[model samples]
Target: MSVRIGFIGVGGIAQSHLSGLLTLPEAEIVALCDISRQQVEKAVERFNKEAVGKEPAGRKLEAAIYDDYRQMLRREKLEAVFICLPPFVHGEVEEAVIEASLPFLVEKPVALSLSLAGKILDGVLKKELITTVGYQLRCGSFMDKARAALAGKTVAAIVANRFGRTPGVSWYHRQDKSGGQLVEQATHQVDMLRYLVGEVDTVYAAAATRINNKDNPEYDIFDSNCMTMTFACGAVGNFGNGTMAHVGVPPGLNGVHIFGDNVQVTIGGNLRIATPDGVTEEPLDKDMMVRQDSAFLKAVAENDPTLIRSDYLSGVRTLAVTLAGEKSARTGQPVKVADLLAAEAPAAL
Candidate 1:
């Protein structure tokens, strides 16, 4: 029997997951919901065309569309759900999903508000639902090698940077909406830093709006961010990102590097490791997002939660770490992640 799925948001990120789910024979996307009904319809048309010859013979895509997610949740007999909403619009959808006792996969930087995220995490834990986050990089084959390379070795520091053009999406330019590049885009690195090194204890950051805002007057998010972090295990990290590049000009440099006891790891388009003994390189064999989708579907089918790497709590922690940096940048003082997570109380859900 195929695992039935419903999507709560049908935006660009949702389509990324949709592309992966369309390849699986056991996955069936039964419903899609978004504020714009037409957006859902268009996504259906796009993916259905891609599903040609992939589905069972003569099985037409009849996925229902909706502008209201609550109605879709009540009406559909879904086995699982994918909440692919933006940073600012996550809490309510997740609460409803948990209330319905359905397993779900939510995209990362889970929510802009830490209190709400913590509340959702608490509810999820109470229900013991199988949940996964969209940090697909963790599903990469190259990541396996990176983890293996660090076995028994301590990671001392992680240094990473990302330079790119402003995303075409309008919400990304608003700090209140997207929380700048650190919270929105470079969050994958923050999550990976935690996965590989350790939990960040403190964050100090500085940022400026150099260029993007000048051209796009309404742009409120900073174009550049530089951050420093101290980890629970005494490891450290320096990460920076900027959104000032031209559309056609490539940043020419992006990725993370880890330094440790006799080990150096580089993760970019591929994975590279150097030790006193030798150097190893691993290239990804498939799309990590697709792999993540496959793993989540399997977890749902078999009721096995261990198959997922980044669970809901992990996503919440990552959001806290990134938001701590944002707060530090604004205040010019180091922000402890624990302090940030503790200051917020769960709002009425």
Candidate 2:
């Protein structure tokens, strides 16, 4: 039985998901919706090209396009939907999806604030719908190996960093729209930390706009940020992010490194472990997004939400950490994740 899928946003990230969906034999993209008609049409053409010679015999490679996801959802009988909108455009689409009781795969930084994410989560829990967030790093084999290597060892510290240029999207530079660089760009690192290590306890952060100025006046987000976090397992971590990086420079120092008593693990494109004996780098084979999509499809097919690694509630926790860091950066005080979650616990799980 093929899972009829509907896409809420056909942006670049959603296109990545479409590539993954094309690889699944039981997945079919039946509808696509976006605010821009041109983007919708372009996505339809791109998806059609990708779907060529990839569908089951007699299955037409056609998708209904709409300017609004609500309209598409009402018109199309879909088994699952993918919400790939940006940080700010979340609440209403999610509410509609949950109201229909349809399982969905939503992109990261679920919302700009915890309060909005909590309300959507409330609907999700009440409806008991299968949900997965786009924390694709959790679906990789390297993560599996990292977890196995750190099974019994006590982690002492973690170092995570992200250095890159500002994205072309204008909203990403605004604090209110994308929740700053920490919430929008460095969220992958934050979520990966939570997955590999335990939950974060406290977060203190400092940020400043050092490079982006008159030349890049539109860039309102902080150009550099340093966040310090403590894990519940007595592990302390620091993550540094910067958007003023030179474009030609290779992004080498852009991942998490964990230090334990006997073994130190480095997680990025590949997993590297340094032990008393030697260092080993395990090259990754599977696409993380593909694995993530496959897991979500399986969960929906089997009616089990646990099959997906990062669900709505877990994603909300990750959001809580990043949002706390943003708050800390603004207030110059360490923010407790528990306190943040408790303050917005009206719809908490």
What is the TM-score (0 to 1) of candidate 1?
A: 0.94
* Candidate 2 Cα misplacement greater than 4 A, ranges: 50-61, 247-251, 346-349
TM-score per prediction, in order, is 0.94, 0.95
Compared with the true structure, what per-residue lDDT tens digits does model 1 show for residues 1-349? 5789999988999987777776677889899889989887877777677668766532445788889999999999999999998888888899999999999999888888788888898899999999999999999888888888888898888889888888887688998889789999999999988888878999999999978877678898888899999999898889988888676434425788999999999887668899999997777557899888889889989999999999898888898988998899999999989887777633211
Once model 1 is optimally superposed onto the true structure by TM-score, how far is the C-alpha of residue 279 displaced, in angstroms? 2.1
Each model's lDDT: 0.86, 0.87
RMSD of each: 2.6, 2.1
**lDDT digits (tens) for residues 143-259 of candidate 2:** 889888888999999999888888887678777788888898799999989988989999999999978765867667888899999999999999999888856436558889999
Q: Candidate 1, residue 272: CA error in Å?
A: 0.7
Native-structure RMSD, model 1: 2.6
| Cα deviation of 251, candidate 1, in Å | 7.1
